[model samples]
Target: MPQQNMGDFTLYFLAFDHGQNYQAMSPEERNKERFTREGVLELTHNHGTESDPSFAGYASGNSDPGRGFGHIAITVDNVEESCARFESLGVKFKKRPQDGRMRDIAFILDPDGYWIEIVPNKLKL
Candidate 1:
């Protein structure tokens, strides 16, 4: 995957790993509580470019076929400040933020276009 030149690729907020804990709960228990407690949270909050069909929201549901909802990538105006604002709204930056002069960090966006945030590394020219 490193060969893809992911170009400052940063996966934030969406990808998660489900421990074998959910299987312990009954389906109804899962929904009434666990569903509300989505941990293996795969959220793809944005879709469509300025051209294609676009609608943004939480992932419709989990599907492994790469057709799950898509992630929102933002070109932020200020990385540090914007990241702080987003962190206030439950959007946590992925632990391993991409660090470099040329690349910037990224986050997820909520429905109001308020969550995801990114800014070019100020240290870069």
Candidate 2:
């Protein structure tokens, strides 16, 4: 897609060790296990024409785990339309486009089971 970025990345570590200890540890503990000076990095992308650029939301982390991290989101022009189009193409949705506690949103899972939140461009939190 013309608006898609091919160089975004999200990072995650295995918070569980088999079935022995399957609990989310504190940030400190998690970092100590494999912490870098930069624990987390959030990236912002601008969309729309240069005259009226809109926030496209955060990009994925530099890396992510199979079943650990939550998701990254993108603001679309229309949630319902986007969901319908993607669904027609066989995209798996973790959540359908509908009302949420804070806003209207939907979730689609990637092949790796990572959720990609889709929200309207005018959505408010």
**Candidate achieving the largest TM-score:** 2
Off by over 4 Å in 2: 1-68, 99-103, 123-125
Local distance difference test, candidate 2: 0.58
Reference-based TM-score of each model: 0.30, 0.42
| 8-111: candidate 1 lDDT, tens digit per residue | 33323322224535446665654455345533343232323333455344342223335654444545457666766766877755421354443457655454
The lDDT of each candidate is 0.44, 0.58
- Give the clashing residue pairs of candidate 2, or none: 9-61, 9-62, 10-61, 10-62, 10-63, 10-64, 11-63
Instruction: State the displacement of the C-alpha of residue 32, model 2, in Å, after optimal TM-score superposition.
Output: 33
Clashes of each: 3, 7
lDDT of 2 at 96: 88
TM-score of 1: 0.30
